[model samples]
Target: METVLGIDLPTWWFLLIGALISGYGILDGFDLGAGAIQLFFRKEESRRIALNAIGPVWDGNEVWLVIGAGSLFAAFPLVYGTILSVFYLPFILFLVAIIFRAISIEFRSKEKMKWWRQLWDISFCVSSIVISLLLGLILGNLIQGIPLNAKHEFIGRLRDFFNPYALLVAITVLSLFMMHGAMYLIMKTEDRIFARLTVMANNTSKFFILCFMATSMATLIYVPHMTDIFKSHPELFILPIAAVLIVLNIRRSIEKRQYRRGFVSSSITTALLLILFAMGLYPNLVLSNADPQGNISIYEAASSTGSLKTMLLIAFIGMPLVATYTVFMFWTFRGKVKLEEHSY
Candidate 1:
């Protein structure tokens, strides 16, 4: 169905889901990345400080994930069900990681036993890494597309999920998150830790930048006709070009020791990457080399027009409030985490 603005309801629904996922990546990506790196914070006090840096904001950051999922269920139930069913094990593992991390975070502080706290710390770090990898895998699967039956249901065994292109995509995303998280650590912490984090950020960002470019080129080469989208629509190349410029800026910012600016630049690069991805796959939500017509387009997977319209209205009204609250929470908690000597 069409909207008052002249666009179809399904278009808006797709836009909503895209925005939610992008927002989640930009917000929670750092927190999860930080948690992953916390494993290396060998000193118990250092680990505690790292945890404190994200403590107040992490829960709020996760809201974007909830919003993204809710938007998918409400606006594009078909896509949601297909994805969940197709990657059932990965999704389950992701959920388990999130749950364990949350539990460990809360319980870690309450436990006075050194071994107990260490166990909790390990759980938090390991879970973060798992969740981040699973997220990347999910995106990889989408890019590679799943095996769909005549009924449009995914009908492949678990082994089908493993492919060169998908694996590359997963590695690229994992590296991106690691860099993003390191940049955040540089921005949020101070003293020697911050300096160390800055060095880590620089190294990881360079490595990931190379990996991203390499994987992107390889994806185009390995996946026959994968570059067709860019070739047919040359305008789409601008997104990646802009992404490269942003990455350059991130490097310069880091070199200058402008941690905040570096973080922002990295985020912009991430945004550009997401935008390019969305544009590259436009019209088709999922694409498969095996079955050309099995492609699931946004139009085919969206909810009913009336339902989409109603949800759009509600989202328009509520999304700003959510954004406001999120920003306020971050602002309230803005500061470097101090060592125990400075603790209240």
Candidate 2:
């Protein structure tokens, strides 16, 4: 195997892509989660505060998703095409949801009419839920294995994306997002709204814990392949152990009224969970059930070694710039949101 900087090109790109996704999940996940439970804030002021809390950074956060998808396409065109083609319908819905979520955020404060604001609030909440569910569905299918033909294409029926297990994963993801969002609200609020959000945060945390436990049990009992790495290399078990502790820390931090710490814990938990997923799928970018031999390994699906080397150079230069921008933006927008005449 040809190596660049002590690692194979394909493996390096895989790690690169995964890191981008982890960035997306941590950055965008809370905003989506905040929107998922928007209707819970009955007062107009409460809703405004919630919306403003994420307003400044929500759009910037989605850049990670765009970058992750583009990186996947650039690094492994075959895997990109095959997976997108497999779940085309959900992708279409996810795209629409993203557009509408942005629209709702912008248009909600454009008018003072009750009906107008109410309409956009519903739009924002539902679209956020849809985006989260669709992401989980795609990830679930990847974990459960897809029906891919010998030609490296999806051969499953359109409805295959809605399998029972996939739906369960959807529940898990939505619940987790809601919890993450609540923590963000708690961190960015004060007064009665702060009190209100703390209660919601605690409730959503329990909801997420339930969904996550069920999802984990289902994966262990039904999706045995996902755990194979842990079985073969006992050291891999540390990922799950770390994820569990982080989840507990989220609850403990919230109980201690440490909102920033709780949010950090949630972010770390998100990264650990994705790392676990990557560990399970390493080497194989997409698995095939229709034809057992049709699996698209990283090496098989990746572009030429020369192309990957070039991409590695671009990624090394580009990602740090992106990270710096994200950090600067968040630091600039830090603190509780205050609604003003210019505020959205």
Candidate 3:
């Protein structure tokens, strides 16, 4: 019942968790996208440059994910428990991909053998692609509502995870990440690599636009609930309009050879899209496909007020430090990547 500003603690925690997840999507998304498109580099030199581009901060980028998961557990234990229990297989696969992707980056250059390097290259690309797709799959299913029983337990078949809507969302996410990664790469390379990435960035932008259009059409047609909030609150329609404008700017930035601006635009577009999603799913952390009564509202899933209050205090004290460290890390590694003897 305790409030921060005008909002209650649970709602504050909800917004905080959403912010952390958005941070993870923006930061880690580019590296994962870069990894997904690494194999397109062809030569070993090109691949190494691509790997080195993300090497200094790839692992650090995952800190947001770790924090986000921990926040979910602390803030909404019921929702967390149900999600992990029901989506056990997908979560496991996601963890495996994370592990493999990390190892691929670390071990790719440990050997000079063509086959050895190629092995990790494929692993890195596949793992990155899988991670992006799985993220989308999870988001899509969450938006569509899960088959939860009266107890808020997942009772759906595993096959339900692969429904057409979820698959479409997954592909859309992959395309978005690829475009995001390409923009990052363009900012961090020169000569042939820069030129190559420019073409790739533009192409991926088109690909993302195509997928985004399809996903928007599908969402309007199939997931009417997602639009309910906007319909009821006509003023909120600006968020999607802003998102569309930002998305358009990404290509404009790229066309002007403003890669950093393009990257920032991609990041903003990502944050806006997720914000729209969170707005649609507001109040309900997890929806129940089986029964609307089973839906786990944020108020229902949240911990005790005392716990939320204490965690909020800790978050305020701790989050700025995390942000500072992230900024310092990125600042230290700023500028186009250069291949050195010890580089990736």
Name the runs in model 1 displaced over 4 angstroms: 224-226, 339-344
**lDDT for each residue of candidate 1 in 216-241, tens digit (9 for 90 to 100):** 78766765454567788897777777
The digit string of per-residue lDDT tens for model 2 on 275-315 reads 98889888899988689787999999899888888888999
lDDT of each: 0.79, 0.91, 0.92
Q: Judged by lDDT, which candidate is best?
A: 3
Flag regions of model 3 displaced more than 4 Å: none
| Model 1 weakest lDDT span, ten residues long | 335-344
Q: After aligning candidate 1 to the native by TM-score, how far in Å is the CA of 120 from where it should be?
A: 1.5
Model 3 per-residue lDDT at 58: 91
- Worst 10-residue lDDT window, candidate 2: 152-161
TM-score of each: 0.94, 0.98, 0.99
Per-residue lDDT of 8 in model 2: 89
- TM-score of predicted model 1? 0.94
Q: Write the per-residue lDDT of candidate 3 for residues 229-331, one digit (tens) a residue.
A: 9878999999999998998998898889898899999999889989989998999988887889879999999999999999999999888998999999999
The TM-score of predicted model 3 comes to 0.99
